[model samples]
Target chain A: MMGDNEEILQQAADWRALGKGVALATVVSTWGSSPRPVGAKLALEQEGAFIGSVSGGCVEGAVIEEGLKAIADGKPRLLSFGVSNDRAWEVGLACGGKIQVFVERVE
Target chain B: MKLGFLQKALAASREGRPAVLATNLTNGLQTFIEATETAGDLTLDAAALQAIRKAVTEDRNATIETADGPVFIEVFNPRLRCVIVGAVHIAQPLARMAALTGYLVTVVDPRTAFASDARFPDVVLSTDWPDEAMEKLKPNRRTAVVTLTHDPKLDDPALSVALRSDAFYIGALGSKKTHAARCKRLQALGFNEEELARIHGPVGLDIGAISPAEIAIAIMAQITQVLRAEPQSDREAA
Candidate 1:
């Protein structure tokens, strides 16, 4: 199905349920090649799977890894990817590009 | 039915749930839209985007009315997120713009000095190695990645990571020369031509932007464009 519409429906329900807190992550900028567009989203919970994205498969582990700290700190964040080949393979990046992820905890 | 999908999807996405709505935009759009229901809260109150939800009948192939704006449901998938790959000047404006659009924004950088709270007062600033950083910041269908730094080292590697995932939008910043050079390098690194097409280099819309703020607007415009996947007919009407 449509990616955003699915995400939107879930977001509305989450809001309706009055989830503890909502955090918004955005892909503000990029270099080289990449997946997701800027302004893409991935919402997180206190402790569970998340919605949205910042990079391809390569950088998600890093994002979720960081999301944990973000929820604990209740602050927002800015993340980055790099232009290295070894790293891409490590995270399964198909293209050689860099990305920046901005995470904000919606108060 | 127009408001049905949009309203329902918005509600679901906010709840950390998932709902798929369909619209006619890209290829295979009809098949996908039909997969999900055109449903939403009966008392939905999206006044601004409301005009876009009218339907001729709940019939399939019914045209989406986007004369007012883009016609795509903001699906209720998971958490709303955005991944910023660089901590540059243009990114500063971009991060703010993303937040305004209701995305959860995270900025990443390896240089602690460049990625300090002082630089980005309101965001989650990380000073970790980018390669290692992306490992934890993996993206899904709802994810988006933008590489702001133009350096091949920073930008290229990050893109490699993004390309391997299902992120919705992937973009890079550079001129024709820079992009050409980048393509050459990527081609040499076992990248197929088709995979490269997913990238939006010379990042941002061609809005004749000059300043960081203007460029930020262009970038946001492009991002919104990809996220909505608005149909050409809707644009013509607008």
Candidate 2:
């Protein structure tokens, strides 16, 4: 665990060891002014529980709900945010930052 | 389910096992790397190091087959760390410098007076023998070992172990004349010329350092040079 996604992998391992269905979300790329770093992680549990962080604070709730669905369905997803002006404001994204988040099921 | 790869890499690193991180930065996929773990009590050889390095550089993350997968590795360097074996006047500044350079530094010595918390305020002070204390420090690809005690009893055994480990930098603080005599003794004890050559004696760069702080700066510079595997001349000027 020495790369950008090292912490994500570590968090995934910790969650899995707890007998939980965990989904790992990574901020693969980002543009403009964003609160979270590029490699920020978000872990969503099967019951809609969550740990770690992706964005600063914007869209976490929506992301968590989406993540819970992914875990319940046992499917992976790629989520995008803040590309357009209206899309950015809906999620409270500042400076119109665009980020691609990859959500993969880790069981 | 198959998380052993990540776990083992971190565990090996936490336990001071010498491991390298290989990152593959390319388009489409994310980071790509194929890091290898050195398993066993036996120290890894230079060939093994080269093999892992080759794996890191050759891991073209530009693209992968649909079945093969995307980027596989990212980042080659580990958490920067260093174990200073000897709590001397110079050790104090060296430990502090190492910490600032992102090294989790540990200063070891049998003398409590020298290895006191007051002297090494920023360092993890260990009053154990040099050899025993390094176990906690756990040298790795990201770790360096420096002998500043200038005591044979401490450095002799410590060097034996440090040289055999995967520490990327091994330096000893002593004058050239003192090291010449020390080298003779080490050779008598079975250390070959090649093994003895690894040590960077007179421990530091060409900087004309007279004070303890300056010496620390020079030594750290030497270490950075070693860690990056780049010639000192090629390093970007600060």
Best by DockQ: 2
Stretches of candidate 1 off by over 4 Å are: A1-107, B1-75, B231-238
For B60-146, candidate 2 gives per-residue lDDT tens digits of 111112332332222233556788888898888888778767677888889897888888775788888877777656676666899
Score residue B48 of candidate 2 by CA lDDT.
38
Docking band of candidate 1: incorrect
lDDT of 1 by residue, B1-238 (tens): 2324435445555554554443322221211122234433322235412322332121111223343322333232455567888899988988888877767788888877778888888997766666667777777766778888888888888788888888888888899899889888888887889988888989889989999889989988888888766533342333
Q: What is the lDDT of residue A22 in candidate 2?
A: 78
Chain B TM (all candidates): 0.67, 0.70
lDDT of 2 at A97: 70
Candidate 1, residue B23: the lDDT equals 31
**Per-model CA lDDT versus the true structure:** 0.63, 0.66
> What is the C-alpha RMSD, rounded to one decimal, of candidate 1?
19.4
